[model samples]
Each structure stands twice: as structure tokens, then as C-alpha cells.
Target: MRENDGKSIIIRRSRGWIPINWRDLYEYRELLYFLTWRDLKVKYKQTLLGAAWAVLQPLFMMFMFTIFFGRMAKVPSDGVPYPIFSYSGLILWTYFAGALSMSSNSLVGGSHLISKIYFPRLLMPTASTLAGLVDYLIALGVMVFLMIWYHFPPSPGLLVLPLVVFCGFLAATGVGLWLSAMNVEYRDIRFVIPFLIQLWLFATPVIYPVTMLPEKYRWLLALNPMSGVIEAHRACILGHKPIDWISLEISFAIILLIFITGLYYFKRMEKTFADVI
Candidate 1:
């Protein structure tokens, strides 16, 4: 073997705990790209409908919410057209749900690769989360078309949409990292994740406006980071008003907390992945 190969093999077999070499991840960026592309292609390959599933999901949900919540329950939509208001929230929420679901199972799904390979285990979940962005963009195109059809012009605040989306990603990734790592040891988290996400969706302001909550409870509601994100999406698209800075700040803080905590937990469990998985 070459000298560098010998050195790498020695390092891999060394005794004490090793710090996660993040620079190695950057060096392997090409692998990350390939993994992400593979997931994207596999998601649509051999499917009759292909990308249509993306547009269909949020569109169908928006219709149901408009029918039941807008018409039946008489839920307020902050004075914007109910379909547009709900569709915007659904677009963001769907991305979060899809990413969370895929990522939580990513390590288990890639067990073959993990057991046989030396790449960063974190890449598995990261690729899954990144792949969900394709669906988000496809679904977002439908939302844009709906906006034009409804005669709603895009607002200047829409410039911040990317930041809002990033926050959603961070939140998803944070929770996903923890779940993916733990799932390697205990498979029960897999079954529990769906139920948790369902509860999370209702807790969020997806079907109804945040204004429907009593003023006294608004601060309490902001404890769920998604509440702030959904409200920001609506405010940006509908121009109903500026974002609630206080809520946004609280949500941002929580995202950071989850991110740091998740990273630590993921790294802590990473070494045992090959053994458990």
C-alpha cells in the first residue's frame, strides 16, 4: 500500500476517542453531491407521475383546509384569500415534514453504505434533507402560479423567504440529526416520529391564522418555532403585515439551541454507528 494509505489505515484503527474531523467532510464534498443527486433521481425514477407529486400534495392539502377550515369552521385567514394563505403555509410545512421523515430514517436506510464505508455518517441525513429541496421548489412553482391567478403580487418582504426557509431547514435538520442517531440503537423512534410530526403540524399555524389564538397565548404559541415561520411566510406572501420580531427572535433562538444540542448528540453517537446499525 502507499504511504498515505498506510497512514489513513493506522489513523482509523487508532485507540483513543477522535474528534469529528469536519474538514474531512469538506474534502469529501463530491461524495455529498453524488449522494444528494442519487436521492433526487431515485425519488422520481420509474414513477409515472414523477414531479407532479410535489405540486399535488400541497395543492390537495390547501383545498382540504380551505373547505373545512375556511368554509366549515369559519377559521380566519388574516384577511387574505383562504387558499393563498393556507397554501403558503402548507408549502413550507410540507418541506419540513418531508425532510424530517426522510432524515430521521436516513441512517437506517443507508446502513449498507455505512457498514461498508468510511465516509462521514452525517452525510446520509444531510443528503436526504437536501434532496427534499427539489420537491419544495417544484411545489413552490405551483404556489407562484396560484398567486398570479389570484391577482396577488409578490411582496417586497418576499426577499426574506430564503432566510425563512433556511430556518425551517435548520429546525428539521436539528431534530433529524438527533432522531437519526438514536434510531440506530432504538428503532422505536422511527414509529414515534410520525405521530410526533403529526402533533407538531396541528400545533403549528398551518390550518388557521396565528391571530385566531388569544393575545395572551401568542407568546406561548411562539415557543413552537414553526409558528413564527408560518406567520412569516404568510406575511411575506400576503403582505398582511410585517413579521412579529419578538416571535421570530424566540424561534431563532430555539433553532440555534436545537442545532447545537443535536450536533453534540449526533457526534456523541456517531462512533457507535457501525456497531449498532
Candidate 2:
């Protein structure tokens, strides 16, 4: 027993938390990879179409918007082809929506692991968000094909695409962290998430061009972080003129603020997870 106790102490101290021990997170990278892979597998497992569902969703949405908005409502598409324009935004929006949904429910979804394991709780939601990126990449392939079909060449500004995508991830993860933490405490948050995402979809520029908004309202619209990301994506992909830099900067700041606050709140609530959950 004495020898066993000494060995256990050595093991515990060797793996003990260091201040800002994000290195441990890196050390646990394999676990994170497996968790992310598990989510991807579970997402498509036993489904008939499998990963093709990613391409189908935005494609179907584009068809509906083309008929309803472009044909009947006569909504503008910033002088770009309607189908390509909407599909670009929809692809990104779909990833955002999917990440938000998965991350928000990650804690509850992994309740069994939380009850049994001692890994970083943050990994659950982060892995859930990361898993959706695979679908985003698959959907992006269709977006590229649509661009070619519409005779739109990729813009030089497309080089900035990665930064724009990071912003989208930040915005989604920021809100998702808050939702996931709150959800662990209040079951109502789970019900509200779908409704919130639905409302957020229309609020975003997925179906309509931001240019259609009055100039005065454009500033207010930029308060939503997705506004900057969507507009940046259009500017990059469709060779649109430069976006309003001020609005993009403001949106970036807001997203950062939300991310910081959400992380803080999540940490505060994390202590109670094993207890309450």
C-alpha cells in the first residue's frame, strides 16, 4: 500500500495542472482528435446519404431562395447570379448553424463521459464545433462548382478567406460557449437554441444581399458578427468592391468581446458541471 501510494502521488503530480496549462490540452490532442472524429462518425452513421447531406442542405436552400426570393419576391443579389450568391452565404451559414447546434448540446450529449472521465470539459464543445468544419469543407466544394457554373472566377481577395472563416468560427463558438454552459443548468436553453438559430438565419445575409438594406441600417446590421463574415465572403468570392472596413473592425471587436466573456462564464460554471450535470 505504501509503494502504491507513492507511485500514485508521482503520477498525479506529473500530470498536475500548471498555470495556463494549455500545454496539457495539446498533450491531450489525440483525445481531442478522437472525440472530433467520433462526432463526425456519429453524425453520419446509419444515414443513407452520409456526408452528401452536407452538400444537399445548402443546395436545397438555394433552390428555395432562388424560386421564392429571386423569382417571386424579386429580391436583389447584388448584381451577381442569385444561385451562386445565395449558395456562398448558405454554405457558410449552414456550417455556423451546425456548429452552434452541436456545440450548444455537447455537454448534455456527453453526459456519460462527464460522469466518468476527467478530461477538460471544454474539449467536448470545442470538439463538437471542430467536427462541423468537415461538413463545411465538403459544402465548400459545391460552392466552388456553383461559382464556375455562374462564370464567376475566384477573386484575388479570396486569399483573405481563411481569416474570414476564422471570424465565423469565433462568432459561433463565442455564442455556443454561453449556450452550452447555460444549457447545463437550464434545460430551457436547449429549446431556445433552435428558435434562436432560425431567427439568426434571417437576420444574416444568407438569403438576401446586405446592399438591399438602407445605408443607415447597414451600420446597425454590422453589429451582428455574421454580417461582417458574410459580406467579407461575398467580397472575396464574387470580386465585389472592398467591404466597409470600419464595420468589419467593429464586428471583430464585438466577436472578441463575446468570446472572452463566454469563456469566462464557461469557466465559472465549469466547476459545477460534475456536481449538477
Candidate 3:
């Protein structure tokens, strides 16, 4: 901390419109933790299945995909079984999907806290995204059991799983920012989220491997950030091939773009949140 003439100088705005204070976020890290914990507990509070629901959402989706796509349509999995292939990717997808959807609504959901408190507004959605990691890890545990049941050895490329997951986090957080800010002013944004995710799932290589698509169409898949994330997950988990560095790079680039632009827009609109909501 520094002071000029005993009056602390605070950064007033980012560039011109966006407002960001990294120091404030660091100072309030405990609030972030409490908010994340609250979200996790609230999610499982009234449910009989409790944490098991986290494992089951992706697990059952895998079962349906296996029965339909694997058995009936004969979907290709790049030399791996469709169930484990889909399950591995689903572990990540389920988390991103939940986090994005929840984060989009978080600001509105926490309107009471937002109106009363002076905490960093970004913390709301960021906490929601981090909270979903619990479900993601539970589903990942199920994935490990599935791998053993299918006798699939860990891929050497599994070393890169952390990188892939980080990309998904960035993408989810980025989209969450934009959506949450928009949702405050325009409530219909919430209705669009479910439909958006449905279309997005088909766009990503979840039930089928990237190789299952035509060569020309494959190029378009990279435009969907999750496409690369899911593809990298499959590659690293099943040893499909060396990591698709090109797609992974493209995904990272998009994640960065989304994060920057989303943060900017969210901050730009943040001044209107209390008044508008």
C-alpha cells in the first residue's frame, strides 16, 4: 500500500468504463470462500441424493449416450469405448454447464446481498463457478471408476488434464460474467440459458469424438471453446493421440478473449446493477 500526502489513491476506473480492483478482490478472499461454501451447501441441502446427484447427472447422461449413440447409432470414439469416452468429457462438461447456468443467475439471486453490501460484484459469479467444482470432482471420481471397470489405463497425456480444465474454467467464468450482467437488466436471458446449453452440447464433442465428424466440419468445431476442451479431455484421458495443440491453442485464445471482453462489459454495466435490478 502506498499513500500520497497521507491520502490513499485508489484506482477509480479501468481504462475509462470498466471498473476493476484486483487489490479489493484479494482483500476480500474470505468473503469469496464463504460465498462458495454457501452455494455448495444450498445446492445439496434439500436433496435426498445429496452429493450423489453430482455423480449421477453425468453418469446417467453417459448411460443414455452409451445406449443410444454407442449401441444404436454406432458412434465412433477414436478406438475407445463410447461410455468411458463420453463419461470423461461429461465430467468436465457437466461442471461447466452447471457453473455457467448458475453464475448467470447468481447476481440476481444475490440481489439482497448486492443491494446491502459493498463487496466486489464479480465475486458473486466467480464464487458460483468455483462452487460447481465440487460436483465436477465427484463426477470425476465416477469417471475413474468407469475407467477401471472398462480396464482403460491412464493416458500419459493425462498430464495435461489440468490445462484442459483451466480452459473450461476460463470459458465458463467469461460467459458467466456477460450473462450475469445482462440478466440483471433483461430477465429473459435466464430463459435462454437452458436452450443455449442444449445447442452447445451438440456442438461440443461430448457423446462422439472429434474424429467422428467430417474433416471439413471439424474445423468449425474449434470455434466452440468447449469443443477443444472436450477433445483435449478425451485425448488426455484415453490417449487418443498427442494433445491437439492447434485446437487447444485456439481454445485458450478464445477463452482469453471472452474473459477480457466479458470482464469489461460486466464492469461497464455494474454501475447500473443496483439501480436497474
lDDT of each: 0.87, 0.84, 0.89
What's the distance in Å from true for residue 52, model 2? 0.4
What is candidate 1's lDDT per residue for 62-117, written digit by digit as tens?
99999999999999988888999899999989999999999999999999988998
Off-target runs (Cα >4 Å) in candidate 2 are 1-20
lDDT per residue (tens digit) for residues 1-277 in model 3: 4565544755544356655878778889999999999999999898898999999899889899999999999998878888888898888999999999999999999998888878889999999999998888778887788888999888889889888888888899999999999999999999999999999999998888787788988889989988988888878987868888999999899999999999999998887788788
> Model 2: per-residue lDDT, tens digit, 35-90?
99999999988999999998999899989999999889999998887888888888
The estimated TM-scores of all candidates read 0.93, 0.91, 0.94
Off by over 4 Å in 1: 1-18
The clash numbers for all candidates, in the given order, read 0, 0, 0
Clash pairs, candidate 2, are none
Instruction: Report the Cα lDDT for residue 79, model 2.
Output: 87
Cand. 3 TM to true fold: 0.94
